[model samples]
Target: MAGRAKRLRIHGRVQGVFYRAWTVETARGLGLAGWVRNRADGTVELVARGEAEAIERLIALCREGPPAARVERIVVEAAPDEPAPEPFEKRPTA
Candidate 1:
């Protein structure tokens, strides 16, 4: 797709809360292209590429993630260096 990309590092009670799976579903539902994975540092990381508005919507939704998630904050930044992923999937824990 011809859209922008953003990298998000979500913090706080994110791991073990099905955050990655939730993210995959959300991203795909938004018709985004990217991947989501759990990090070793107890965070959820996502690289999403799609319409800027869609990406913004995803970020807003992530602030209030799955029922079990207690998202404290998210670090968002441009990820123009990242190649867009396809089909929005979940990746192995990093």
Candidate 2:
């Protein structure tokens, strides 16, 4: 079965707070595949692909990121072209 993919642009106090690392751990734990990276604009961007349920779970968790994150909002959209890299990873800042 094909999996679902979503690109998320998280805003507010997300940079330099280990958000990418936290996302990698969370996505991996949820058996997801994709990549997370920090944007130069001070936002955290990630593409998560996996079971639809798992994707939703990941989004919900993202709203309350790690202890250091003060998530203000998350803009999510379909990511039809984003590759599902196995074992999730934190990519270099874009």
* Candidate with best lDDT: 2
Backbone clashes for every candidate come to 0, 0
- Candidate 2 ranges with C-alpha deviation above 4 Å: none
Worst 10 residues of 2 by lDDT: 80-89
Q: State model 2's lDDT.
A: 0.92
Task: Quote the positional error of residue 19 for candidate 1 in Å.
Answer: 0.8
Give the total clashing residue pairs for model 1.
Answer: 0
Per-residue error for 61 in candidate 1, Å, reads: 0.1
RMSD of 1: 0.9
In candidate 1, how many Å is residue 67 off?
0.3
Pairs in clash, predicted candidate 2: none
Q: How does each model score on TM-score?
A: 0.95, 0.95
